[model samples]
Target: MSFATPLPGPDGDPLVVDCDSCVVRSPGACGDCVVSVLLGPPQDVVALDDAERSALGALADSGLVPPLRLMTLDDPPTHRDAS
Candidate 1:
């Protein structure tokens, strides 16, 4: 599956947040906020390619990483989820 490029996060470089309790963080969603945490400063959103997706998958599963897509996630549909 295609994802996005790995960028620094709004918080720190190599940003890695905890999403272990995320209800939607399972394969489709991801457990931790890795993507966002690692996401670099704000920039035009770019679609991820196959290679990028592989890299993201590996990066998101490390020690403590979560999909930080929320870091830069624009006003998309919202949902209430509990882990």
Candidate 2:
């Protein structure tokens, strides 16, 4: 599957899920991820807003659903001159 790019969400909140960048992306992890649980299977990208994220967090906290297991890559390192 292709990596997910951030999308514009409600209130200008950017996308929260980038499965391709996730560090724990796997069949087992996907099954427990909120994206997979709610959206079903994996997709190229999954966009979620602040409200949606909060709601999902609540559900996960209440044990109603699994939390989002998205561990994306860290920020890229800055370049420096060796000379």
For each candidate, what TM-score against the reference? Answer: 0.34, 0.70
RMSD in angstroms between candidate 2 and the native structure over all alpha carbons: 9.5
Lowest-scoring 10 consecutive residues by lDDT in candidate 2?
74-83
TM-score between candidate 2 and the true structure: 0.70
Q: What RMSD does each model have against the real structure? A: 11.1, 9.5
Per-prediction count of colliding residue pairs? 17, 0
lDDT of predicted model 1? 0.40
Q: Tell me the whole-model lDDT of each prediction, alpha carbons only.
A: 0.40, 0.60
Model 2 regions lying over 4 Å from their true place = 1-12, 75-83
